[model samples]
Target: MDEIRAKKENKEYDWYVLFVKVGYENKVISQLQSYFNKKMILPFLPKLEIFHKYSNGYIEMEYKILFPGYVFVESNLNEMKFISMIKEFIHYYDAPLKLLKYGDSYEFAMREHEKSMLQSFCNIDFCIEASTGLIKGNKTIVLKGPLKGRESIIKKIDRSRRKAVINIDIMGKCVPITVGLDIPIKLP
Candidate 1:
């Protein structure tokens, strides 16, 4: 029981952000997982599920990176050891992998609140599904999905494109992430 509790607490707080070359996020994740066993480290790439429409009226579901070129990781190793391990393993990959640093210093681990906020938006697989909502007067009420109770974080809503932009502060930077939202009903 104690072991399980400790692990859950560790997962909630110990997330590090890595910046990989654009379009090589998956490659880096796979390489890291293979290099170190899955139990040693877990990499997460949050994706947004959206619908793509074709001229023939066929709609297809597609996944796009919620935060491109960035991958979040939870590892059991200490900070220095983890950094050393990643630095050594990075040479094997074709793409570049660097830990996100601030102002000439290495501050890789995310704050607990930041990780918690991200987890709330993403599911177990780190995917943010499309949110269904209704427009009531000037307000948007998310009836179902990850955005349901988090409407206050919405910075802008593009109804036609079915996307909502939310500003999330991660690694001490405010990033605007666009997620899928469908407001099918409008009530006066």
Candidate 2:
């Protein structure tokens, strides 16, 4: 708790918690990391960018981070107090609960990450390849679970949601589905 106004006009706080509007989480996280040593959790997102390889083995890269907003922050009481000094436009997600529950510790960081980290949006073909290396497990590039027959290409990866465009041979139409970074839908 920092006493910005001490003595006669003093105000005290136990901790701090805040939520950045969509697309602003990164801005705040970057600023905080550079300015202070406070611990923080910014749910990382993966963006699909086009990559090309030349015959000479020259490689090119281009992409964007998928998810936006929805960041969970954790830090020490003393360090977090500095958040008050921030003048950016942001709102508190769960101010008291976040402050009381999370702090400067590995457990706090891991817990926050587990709660908001990547979730599988949809399953692709067996050897499905992504521009990023976020995919996990023995599934390799192939998505695990029931969405096996689905061979779709990522049409758009938005901060709010991911759009996968799949061409249905039977229907002869493209279908788009929104999926997170988690395992695709379970087999029906």
Candidate 3:
């Protein structure tokens, strides 16, 4: 059985970020997963864009790199020699070490975190939606918080008491919340 400890030392699967060509994250992930099943995670991402159908008869659209230049890899800390093969398969710009921790669970958590961060980077950094009393009709900027600078469009509201609801879609999950305003809300 796997042990869950309060703390651990050393880890397998270090966090890394690779700058790569757009639309290739999955390709790299696929190649890697084919070699290391259940041992990897390639979170799906959607780049929602407002397309313009020009009167001049051309349709143009913008694409957001939901997960830009990154694909998270999970591996044994003591075994990272073949990680470079991932770089080659993905045609990556480069691979860089992201963080170091003292235990296995922590390290695993960090690896998952890097993956989630990569997948959510653009959306969380650009948009927010608030649907709450008092804060109604107000597009509150994320002045400061865990999601600092990450803005979204208001989808629902309940602002009678200095609160707002923000929405975020992560790894294909929708997370809507009642949050703060002009205050440093403590994060968990």
Candidate 4:
């Protein structure tokens, strides 16, 4: 019981942001998991479930990366240890990895508030489903899911492509996240 209490009291991990090759986010995650103990590190790539339309009355569900080239990781290890682990992993793959940086000196770490916000938005599965929204009088109204109450974060909505481009601040830098939306179905 005391051990459990101690563990709860000492939450040592912070969410760190990593920038990888645009299409290599999943590959990097797989490599990290294979190299490190899965319990010691948690990597996340926010994905969206999109419905692709096809001719002859066919629709297919597909998963798309929400933020291309960016991945978030949570770990209890200290910064030096984490960096060392990443360096070792890169050495094995012969691919370069970079942590988000501020100017030239410091690594940009995600703020607690930002982390919590992302957690709430992504939930435990780390995947956001396509939301259904309607455009009325030049305003977009989300009808369901996490995007409903957080409409303000959306910078632009692409109706034809059914994608919402949201602006989020990470470590004082504004980054854009693109999420898919289901085409609005007309109510009968």
Give TM per candidate.
Answer: 0.87, 0.29, 0.33, 0.77
Worst 10 residues of 4 by lDDT: 1-10
For model 3, how does the per-residue alpha-carbon lDDT over 80-119 read when each residue is reduced to its tens digit? 4434444355454343322223244333233455345534
Candidate of highest lDDT: 1
Please give the clash total of every predicted structure, in order: 0, 8, 21, 0
Q: Higher TM-score: candidate 2 or 3?
A: 3
How well is each residue in 6-103 modelled by candidate 1, as lDDT tens digits?
58654543678888888888888877778886766788788888766687867667899988999888877778888788778766666777777554
Q: Total backbone clashes of model 1? A: 0
lDDT of 2: 0.33
How does residue 31 of candidate 3 score in lDDT? 55
How far off is model 4, as Cα RMSD? 4.2
Give per-model CA RMSD.
3.0, 15.1, 12.5, 4.2
Cα error, residue 5 of model 2, in Å, equals 37
- Which predicted model would earn the best TM-score? 1
> lDDT, candidate 2, residue 1?
11
Mark the regions of model 2 whose C-alpha exceeds 4 Å error after superposition: 1-18, 38-62, 72-188
Model 4 regions lying over 4 Å from their true place: 1-12, 183-188
The TM-score obtained by model 1 is 0.87
Pairs of colliding residues, candidate 2: 119-180, 119-181, 119-182, 120-180, 120-181, 120-182, 121-179, 121-180
